[model samples]
Target: MIFPTQYSMLSTEALKSYLEEAYGLNNLGCKLLIHNVSDTYLLAGVDDKYIFKLYRDSHRKLDEIKAEVELLNILKENGAKISYPVTDLKGGQIQSFNAAEGIRNGVLFSFAEGKPTHDYYDSRLQTIGREMAHIHNITADIELQNPRKVYDVRTTLIQPLEYIKSEFTELPEEYAWLQSTTEKVVEKIRHFDLSKFSYGYCHYDFLPHNFHFDEHDNITFFDFDFAGKGLLANDMMTFYVHFFFQVMLKKQSQEEADKNFQTFISAYRQVRAVSEEELAAIPYLGFAFWVFFLEFYQLHFEDWSNTFYNLRFKKERMGWIRNWVEWYCRF
Candidate 1:
């Protein structure tokens, strides 16, 4: 018997054959695009293209996967520009594969046209803001049959620290700093009038890399894997993270970053109402974003990217968090 395998890479050829049969496509080509928590594949045909994402059971269970599909369908129906899932001939949106580790789920999405752009000119910033607001308009207060993850203090701040404590055994000072900073963020958020905050489903990872801009300058957002129920401000906070990195890397000055972000905020306000208080809460919310991903990286180290999560990465990540706190947070 094959030794109990924890993770397995599905054969690209087998997947191509299976998808051709499953979707009734001809002359298809399948190649691995990314091998992260969930595996991504690029499927090309003579006339069209599609993205196939295979979810790891450990990363996203079937229920959560269904929730993601359901959310995408709703967004598509409501005219949000997203790379929605394609249905098979049998009217099924999800495909189940029996792998060495057990059953894995996959979905085929209409390929988002064009490429991701790093430069956020005024037009692109406006487009990003409007598009994000469009999504928020649809996702706000929406309910799904299957539940996705919920972002809150417990899940994003407290639990992440708990999950990553063991990894910081050798660097107790860093861990302690994280702990104290998390407490400060939690307290600050608690003091806010959260009842006035816009409540909704959020694409919690709204970074530039998750979207593409076509030649026509139209945007198509994809990779809703980390979407969940949370404050709508969480989405804005995530987008702000893009600017934070730009400033951190010295690609742009703080003034340029803030100006760009303000441009996005202005465009967003044209579509939806955002409270000043919610805007003020971004720093605290951004802290949770970093901490949550730190735990995610630590948790998925073995299967996600073992080499990328070594001691050096941990120290670098800690530095990032510290910088975030110092630059953004008062306490």
Candidate 2:
């Protein structure tokens, strides 16, 4: 389904062979344990750790990955606890390899030990909020060269609409509704004055899966593959839309949703206060995120539906967009 290139290409035997060749482990009695996280490859051995990210799409460039590594290195240098990119003995930021499938570009990194933030307490959310603010503060002054813009709501919606219209046939009724809804949302988004919002480099996708928390409640952010220049409000809104709206609010009552939103916003505002104007923009951003979700799901639905595990959840996958649009209009 969501098979990343590295995971699909490198099997257990292949990993062992590669490690044995790369690290001269032929004589040494060691085993390579490969961890298959969604969309990335991670391997752990007796005394070594490495993360391998496969270049699945052409949207990301090698230079952009280098920029992300530099940004993380800078964050670590500034006292933020993060996984630093590991260089080979010959000193290189990134290592390139040619597999039979395609060019697999990757950077090795030492693993940062922690669990995902979902297992942590609500107090830990406050700590995460503060730490995220600190990260933003540190990065605000550092100017990046030729940074690409992360995929936003507008592009996410429009691109897929064109794709579905051109490629897909025998349209399902629900998909037809999605297409119509996207057009309406696009009109609303275009009317909004986006120039009034503040823009900066941000971690475009900050979900619980992308963050880690230690025993002491220290939060470390990771997965900068989607990081880029964008509106800070949209960045924050993306997190809210993913965690609260999609995960929690969808399953619970409106009262529960409002409570959780207040908690997150309160904690976030303690470090950086969002203005009234930005607060008003949250609903529109939420609507945009709905479009984004629909587009992403439409692109991946076929592959995902074919997978054994993902097939079970296929029916519920793209149903949230309608409720999201309704909520946005009411708000």
TM-scores of the candidates in the order shown:
0.98, 0.76
lDDT of 2 by residue, 149-187 (tens): 565554666765665453334346656776777677667
Off by over 4 Å in 2: 1-8, 11-39, 45-48, 57-59, 117-120, 139-143, 166-176, 242-252, 293-315
RMSD of each: 0.9, 5.0
Q: Model 2: C-alpha RMSD to truth?
A: 5.0
lDDT against true structure, model 1: 0.93
lDDT of each: 0.93, 0.61
Residue 279 local lDDT, model 2: 64
lDDT against true structure, model 2:
0.61
Cα lDDT tens digits for candidate 1, 192-277 = 99999998889999998999999999999999999999999999999988888999999999999999999999999999999999
Best by lDDT: 1
Which residue pairs clash in candidate 2?
A: none
